[model samples]
Target: MKNVVITGTSRGIGFELAKMFAKNDCRVLALSRNTKPLDDFNHKNITTISVDLSLAEDIKKAVSFVNSNWKKVDILVNNAGKLINKPFTELTSEDFLEVYKINVFAVAELTKNLIPFLQKESHVVTVSSMGGIQGSMKFPGLAAYSSAKGAVITLSELLAEEYKEQQIAFNVLALGAVQTEMLEEAFPGYKAPLSATEMADYIYNFALTGNKFYNGKVLQVSSSTP
Candidate 1:
């Protein structure tokens, strides 16, 4: 069975992604800050780990946990991220650094730490946002978050090119608003965001499709009219 490592598995898209992969008979290693109840689900193919990705030591522990046991990770989903919706001026320097630490630094470091263990033809999907692509007129009060995502996309592009010889795939899921707790907190009364499971389904398909034709690209998925 293919081995997949998914971060942010406590809830939202990450939770659903873990479930779907396990159901499809893949060996799933899920990481989150708090996964106390993960044992309750109790699937033999699933291993849930609780490690706060924002903390550098926690990130090291998580990567080492997977690397020691899983010989080759067939898929890696960098799904854990945070957003600070406060205005640019309102955000302290620490706030901006914390945001990047959780959203971008963690993802990049975790991937860097584990790339040696990734399979030759593996898929690496970084969950980003449309806010990462461009400035949003649909809303305001997220200058840092938007800019971080944009940086993530650029990183994905460079990694995609750098790893082309190995046939390893890298893709970014530029997500539109979704109905996660984060979204509810970021934009109250936001209309028509995709459900967590719906987004998970889209991501699951992309990861499982190892047809060699799909690699190093960004797939935009959403329920918005735009």
Candidate 2:
């Protein structure tokens, strides 16, 4: 069974993704700030960890878990993200930093620490947003959120190149609006075409096999104009 580590697993896509992988016989380490939801499910293949990705110590705890238990991670899904809906003029430096801490810096730090455990054919998938794509539709009040998402896409591309010789693959999925809590928070009452479970299903499959066909690439997983 492939060992998988998924972040933001308390709810939405991450929660569903965790169950999907576990049901498929993959060993999963599910991390989030709240572990209750996942812990209650208590699937034999799923292990829940309380992790606030913004903190270096929490990240270290995750790394230590992997080092002590799995030793190797077949898939690392950087699925955790933070979004702040504030107009540009109203946005603060701290706002930008808070978003980047979770969406960009945490991804870099976690992936960097996990590199040694990722061997040939290992895949690292970082979840991004359509708003992050340059020249794509830009939304107001998402300056920090969207920019941070874009930063992670570039970070993934660079890592894919740096690890090419090791046969490890890194890819980014720039997703459009999904009916997730995060989406609702950013755009209240804005109905999305896909559901969280639907998106998670797509991500689950892609994380498993997309590396064979592409690496250092960003796949825009959107069916809508937004």
Best model per TM-score: 2
Per-model lDDT:
0.82, 0.96
lDDT, candidate 1, 1-226, per-residue tens? 9999999888899988998999999999888887865567788889987888878788788677776887688999999887888876798888788889878888888889888887678989999888776654445777778778788888888888999888888888888878888787778777545789988998899887832666667767765732
Which candidate tops lDDT? 2
In model 1, residue pairs whose N, Cα or C atoms come closer than 3 Å (at least 3 residues apart or on different chains), thus clashing, are none
**lDDT value, residue 45 of candidate 1:** 89
The C-alpha local distance difference test score for the whole of candidate 1 amounts to 0.82
lDDT of 2: 0.96
Clashes of 1: 0
At residue 114, candidate 1 shows an lDDT of 81
